[model samples]
Target chain A: MVSTVTTSLADVASSNAALRAFLHGLPGVDRVGADQRAAMLGTRSIKTTAKAQAIDLAISMVDLTTLEGADTPGKVRAMSTKAMHPGEGAPRVAAVCVYPDLVHVAVETLKGSGVKVASVSTAFPSGRSSLEVKVSDTALAVAAGADEIDMVIDRGAFLSGDYLKVYEEIVAVKAACGDAHLKVILETGELATYDNVRRASWLAMIAGGDFIKTSTGKVQPAATLPVTLIMLEAVRDFRATTGTQIGVKPAGGIRTTKDAIKMLVLVNETVGDDWLSPDWFRLGASTLLNDLLMQRQKLTTGRYAGPDYFTLD
Target chain B: MTRLSVRKTYKLYIGGAFPRSESGRSYVVASSKGEFVANAARASRKDARDAVSAARKAFAGWSGATPYNRGQILYRVAEMLEGRRAQFAEEIGGGKKAAAEQVDAAVDRLVWYAGWSDKIASVHGSANPVAGPYFNLSTPEPSGVVAVVAPSDPFLGLISVIAPVIVTGNTCVVVCSSPMAAITFGEVLATSDLPGGVVNLLTGFQKELVPGLAAHMDVNGLDLTGVDDPELALKAEQDAAENLKRVIRPVAEDWTAEPGLERMTRFLETKTVWHPVGI
Candidate 1:
């Protein structure tokens, strides 16, 4: 995998003041327009061949996530194995997402299987810890063989208009990731408005986020279509301007095959087909994988299967 | 001066909310005298799917509730039904005396099943004498979401079929033949303490909706009590077997009579668990 655009992040914003100015200078989002666009894209009928393909593609794009405080090594291993071999002939998930401490367990289980290990660090779900602890959290996961680092932005800082604190924190976490691809979670639900979501997307991108994510799966209204659409638009617009492509991942509450297909439609229409791959897009979901597997089975077999047939990791 | 009477639009009950069929299709229901009653929401395949989704979502909570709690809820349904006796009697379209009897039987049937809610497990479950040093226990559990093709008798049959399915904590999506009476029944459910989605009532042709419910992978059990035609019942059974769904065959019966626990037990799955007796 190519390194994240970390070096140029410094070039884009030489100082904290410069980063703040750049984020604020970005255009505001029209909430109604974003919602309308999301609803319009959601109505796209993907059936038969396109649906079958989309189901498989969506399955492959999943960052099968389990970020509970009670997650054990055994649970991580089971989830990793599930990620690698969801079902017979079904494509493996893009990665297995877990808390920072369980990265090694996932790494050991997923060894040689090609599924990456993504660890959420930097006091994930709420970036309230000091920069020292957050950096060490990222460094620990990286040293433990995590292939990707999903860090949460300080919503407290972002909401308080301290854009510099949130930007520098993302940059610091990205650097701590070393070569591991950095996915910056905006926690868009806590951002309160679509305009804040739009600004956070640009902030994470300009500060060297290889992927801009919508949530930590910890908040209500997480990873909604309209919120995700704004991030997709940000990546599309950012790619057009800077010749650098940043991926988009919508996490949480996307549990059905139907929901995943709608997100795929959003990506297809918003960023075109370029962002459809696992490298460019991901669905940070846990329950969604089983539904996708069920739909895939329905397409292949001519008969429907039950949840009893699928293993829940 | 003239006074105009207000009539209610009989709509499908899904996920606790009354929604017109997604297809926006409706059918007219006329009385035996050939007078127009009301325009009922003619639900399609999509509505069946939606109702199944709702029933499936409600299954976890309803099935997991304490049996005592379930008994209380079922008894509450009986109480609500009793309070709406006049409305249900009027909707049944017969003379007040016969309709009143049907309504009373329906309410009594609910109370009867409500008493079985906590007792069914004890009656059905057993502790087996195992060959090894283990405690082997078998119990019955609600078999997820059930799809009911309610019998033609709108009042008593509807209550009889639905009461048994829900008494043991299995949520249901019912396709009713009498749309007007079903909608009036829905008002009682809404007013009762029962949770939304516990029992979704749909008014449409069973031929149009049954196929979708039968074929839905999420629905675990099917009650074909209303299907009198052999061919339709056979087709529904075949479609239901796509997921190996547990099916209750349609039987000609009197709904007003004393219902045995068979209807309640038919929708249940037996689960046996073994644990070590000693350290």
Candidate 2:
């Protein structure tokens, strides 16, 4: 959590040019090595004593998310309440993620619970809108008392080699976020390569993203082990170079306790123990919470609870 | 070089693919006369858990399949079994006459069950003569994933217990004792049109796998036909109660005898529906 280099909005262009040089000049990743490392870490046998602790840690690091056009005030409220108390003996989730329109409902429901409300903005899932509108989206969510703003990077610009444009948009959104923490979503599925993922990780970090995220949970191949592994290496190297550690969130397709535990293992080995907490690592999933709760109950009490026993919120 | 014999490695079948036991353990198998057969994968509790997961995943598509399609798939399994008759007969390891008879019975049993798939519902379902002005009906539905311990009669007994459970659209994980016969049978299932996970066969000790399968929350039923030890069978029954799994206790019976509706009905859950006459 040390500060090394600061890239301000006034210096975004020159900083982006220099940042591009740094990120591109960064050593190219060998895909086979990254996958092999992830596979080996996945095989690490987390036994009874450690499994119980790992399940709870995974629970606390979850950002219980529901982002859909069908979202409603009641749905947001119920999910937020579930976020506060997942089950008996279960700890509160790190945050409740919702669309900008329902941020107020989540904010009100999570009041006094110490669970932050995260709103997804900037034309989310698809950042095809103008900068003015995207900034306003962040502004509205922040004004509505969102403690965190999850923004989507302009992949179109990034893919077209307009790294500076993507960097400046993030800078503008960061300015709009004001006091709220900013999470930049790379939607690595669309980025198409491990190299692009590494470059996007650096772009977000240099532009002041508090956390570099893997997906928006709306595309196929959203989050994968190899992709997340490459991102963890990016954040780990970023901290070593800049002296500041940024968080990593892998959203989508992670639905079981085993999947969550493997992610924790990846973070533990790749970035070391410092990134294992909710402050540094997160799983953007909803169904995964119930699995963790079920596993936790199994560890505490020697019986498995049926789906009917847990609330479906 | 004198003829190089390609000795086969016997393994467990889960999710339609052959894989070694997750525990990397294997046990030696031999004939009743103590003749060396082969080293078969001795599946562990972890393997049982994996098979249960595979069965659960395959349940929806399997149970949702049309009865006609299921029947066709079961019939296709019989056709494949017929083609591999010599292999099964040799694996069962008796004199030619007895082995051929056992293989024939197994194939015929599959065909019989295949025909029953489309007819069992019609024979079991009833429209009640209720006292009120309402339409009340009861129909049988597949009871989700089932766990089976294949019977002692390696070939015919294995077919008898498995056919009835899956014929009703239920997916199952079977723990067979006879490694040679079970693996050979697994080859037939793989070649058959039956879906990959519809009938997972694990070659290992029933004592090792039965407890894990019985206790698995995802498994909805238990068919302990292969478990001969009364004490072990009782323990599995107790473990199954954790999830209130439908229990099918093992019984002493001749595999070649006429099978009853009891095996079919035991694994079916009768769902009753009521509707007003006006509607």
Candidate 3:
């Protein structure tokens, strides 16, 4: 396989033709190999002290998301409070993710609490809106004091081999984010192939996204191990040539402590300690926090904790 | 050349699937005459934890099901067991006549419990006579996941303990000594309409398995009816007290005798609600 890690990030996005060539020219993902490696990594025990520490770290790395259409202001406030103080003596989550309209509630609730507020934009889960609308949607969230903007890429454009459109959209949304961090959601379930996931990861990073996320938690086959593995490989390779570190957030379907620990194992094995912190690696999920808290309680108290004690997401 | 006989491996049943112990350990089982019967999976604490997790996962769907629907499923389990009678009879292994009789009794016992599903509510629940302008009523709801320690009678005792717990919608993790018979019963339940995790059967040393379950904060009830050792039962009761678990003490009762409503009622919580009367 030829090395497709471009030395220069600027020239690749210069034109649609150049962006397409750069993406297509990137090496293909060995589908079977990635699946096998992820499965193997998942078998890691991570026992006792290591497990306790990983649970806390995974809890802190959670985005504490609730992106439903029925999300009320009260819901967002409750989620924000839960994110701040997950449980007694437990570390707070990294951020509270909601739709762009509710960013103010999350931001206001999370103020001075050090828990960042992330808002999903660009027509969210579908990304079917116009570029003007997408940019303004992102701007609205940023204006509402969102610390981060999670923007979805147009899969229709990307799958039709219009890599340039996807790349440019990320760039546009990144520009709209201002001082806030921009996380580009590939919605990898719709991406269809590991090869596309790799190319999309590079596209998001090159276009100045602070993090490349997996799914919107609205899609099935979301945030799988093999997909996250491919994205982690992309961010690792991107950081190698450019010396610019990008984050990876595997959202959705990661609802258990075991699944969360497996993600941490993948990060530790693939990218080492540099990306271990919440600023670098994150888990975007709603139901996952309670499981993490439950596991944490088990580690400390030596008895299995039930879902009854924890607040429902 | 004559074909070699394929012997079945007796495994633990958790979440409706036959999985070997997580510890990768198995123990030898002997017949009444002390002859080698089979190798049974010796479950560990992790396995117990997994069973509780599975039981907890199945709780909502099983509990929320309509009483009539649950009745049909329980009846379906009996139908499945009836077809597998000979196999269960052979595994029960006292004598041909005794084994057959026990399996029949088990089937009848199940059918007996199945009949109680829809009717139990009306009989146990009450319309309270309050001295005010309101309608007050009390009904029994399944008290979440319960852990069972099965008695040594194998087939009938296993059926009696499990049938009552599940018929009312409470899910369970059972520690039984008779591996072969329990696993066969597990197969019957799996193919039946009853959901997996509703009855997770673990065959192992009760000493190792009982304490963990008794102390589990997730398990809502503990049935120590099968514990013959007084000391072990006492320790489990103490651990159970940590979580305020509702427990049933052991009794030297005959399995063939008529079972009362107490077995089902013991693991149930009375939900009393008051609704305003019609204007």
Candidate 4:
């Protein structure tokens, strides 16, 4: 019996080492820097129509941001009101992302529209609050009619090699979300490394994040390809681990069709055909729509639609 | 020797006393010999709520203690468990070897987490590079009043789940395994000199008790690591959303599988402070 236990322990240790080696050797694309720029330039001329349609599909699927910092309740209400009906031909953005306290206004305004009201909770931009307050914030958001909650993980904990703490907090936040989808924001800029990003992504999924997001859009150096690549790999691994499909949202600084297609490619390559649909993928951007529309007109008419083809409401 | 059938009744361990299930309902727990032991109490939603209240009330002093002091107290629990190893071994049906290892691992894990009280912040924290020079340092903190579903399995698994939550200064209301192990462990908790509500144990069907705790608006977090069923874990996650409770989905490993420090830190929150650097 003693020998059996010893051998089992040894086997577990060796197998873990092999698995680590295998992960370390896997080819990872960095979608954040020069590599992403090259990829974007390479695909810039792929006949704007197909690309426009894809970008439109991605944008329509996304939940864009409208409120942040200390915007007044009235301004938030107005933003939601305008967001609901942006005139006749305007392609509607998916949803409005806001602070927890303002979730109800957006939810109330967007009622009957399929658009969701997502709230950034658990200390958005910087997750430097107590778990009690964070959980309360999340619960309060859900109660206030937040269709989704975007939570920031304790990057401090993750950096310290405390994967379990990061994982546990994501789980707790997911629980607090109830029916509302929980988007675990990695705040990739703070994560610093692709390896950390990959691990953080898996940790979030296992801990119950419905969607693993790229950034809160508040931080600098947001949304790069390498980071997105690592996250996409994480989503794929999570699917393999639990046989469940999780969503991915890359927010902050995504402003053009070129940017949108690269993310789509990363998702397509990493998770394959199943995740290409809107249900599994979303972009959180306020400016990517018009660029897509401009490119779409160029594709059909074979002439530049110029800068005025799209209007910002 | 004549065979004697000993009727086992599952009971509730509250405030250092083992009492009949307040609900007046008793369920039979079978021993390895296939004979029934004492009937244990099946705790109700009220009981879970009451447990949370007790734990919340106790949090101030428990979390306020110096890490070294908490470490010593946890070490004391280990000593108590070691002294009572024979009782656990016999009750849980594990022989001396399994029981000894379980007790040692639980004790070691407690010590490991106790040492982390003062040190975790330093190890898991840093100062960020902001656009402006500001005095900023991030430190890990405790998420309060956690409601944990103790591993449904006896002995080792139960200890694995409960120790990590408490070591981090978060008080817990634990629904322990349904069988005889909860009672035995409850005895250890009673004598461990742990504060009255610091570690509350409930022995009953986890499915019935978990929803109450998960949906409890006051409970800060839910660790559902013990619910093996994916459906139950999913339901617990959904229920936790009502109050936006922190939900920890079940990991595939056994309680003793990972180093307990990881679990301890997971229940912690990091507080980072930034002050402008314009001197």
Lowest summed lDDT across 10 adjacent residues in model 3 chain A is found at A1-10
Q: What are the per-residue Cα lDDT tens digits for candidate 2 across B1-279?
A: 699899999999999999999999999998889988799999988788778778888888999999989999999999999998888888898788899999999999999999998899889989999999999999999999899998867589999999999999999999998878888888889998888999898988877788778777778899988898999999989999987899988888788889988888888999999999987
TM-score of 1: 0.88
Q: What local lDDT does model 2 show for residue A285?
A: 95
DockQ of each: 0.36, 0.33, 0.75, 0.00
lDDT for each residue of candidate 1 in B1-279, tens digit (9 for 90 to 100): 787988798899998999999989999898999988789999988788778878888888998899999999889988998988888888897888999998998889889889998999899999999899999999999989899999877579998899999988899999999888888889888888889999999998978878778877788899999987788889989998877788989998877677888888888989999999875
**Each prediction's TM-score versus the true structure:** 0.88, 0.93, 0.95, 0.46
| Model 2 iRMS | 2.9
Per-residue CA lDDT of candidate 4, range B1-279, in tens? 998977555567765567666666756677668786656677876577667767788888788877667777777787887887676776766567886677677666666666766776677778777787798888777788898887766467777777778877888988876557677677777888788788888887877788778766567778987887788788789877865667778876656665645777777888988888886
What stretches of model 4 exceed 4 Å from their correct place? A1-44, A81-91, A296-313, B1-279
lDDT digits (tens) for residues A130-219 of candidate 2: 999999999999999999999999999999888989988999999999999999999999998888999899889888999999999999
Model 4: per-residue Cα lDDT at residue B72: 73
Winning model by lDDT:
3
Model 2: residue B261 alpha-carbon error in angstroms: 0.7
For each candidate, give the TM-score of chain B: 0.97, 0.97, 0.98, 0.88
At residue A116, candidate 4 shows an lDDT of: 77
Q: Put the candidates in DockQ order, highest first.
A: 3, 1, 2, 4
Please give the range of 10 consecutive residues that has the lowest summed lDDT in model 1 chain B. B208-217
- Candidate 2 has a TM-score of 0.93
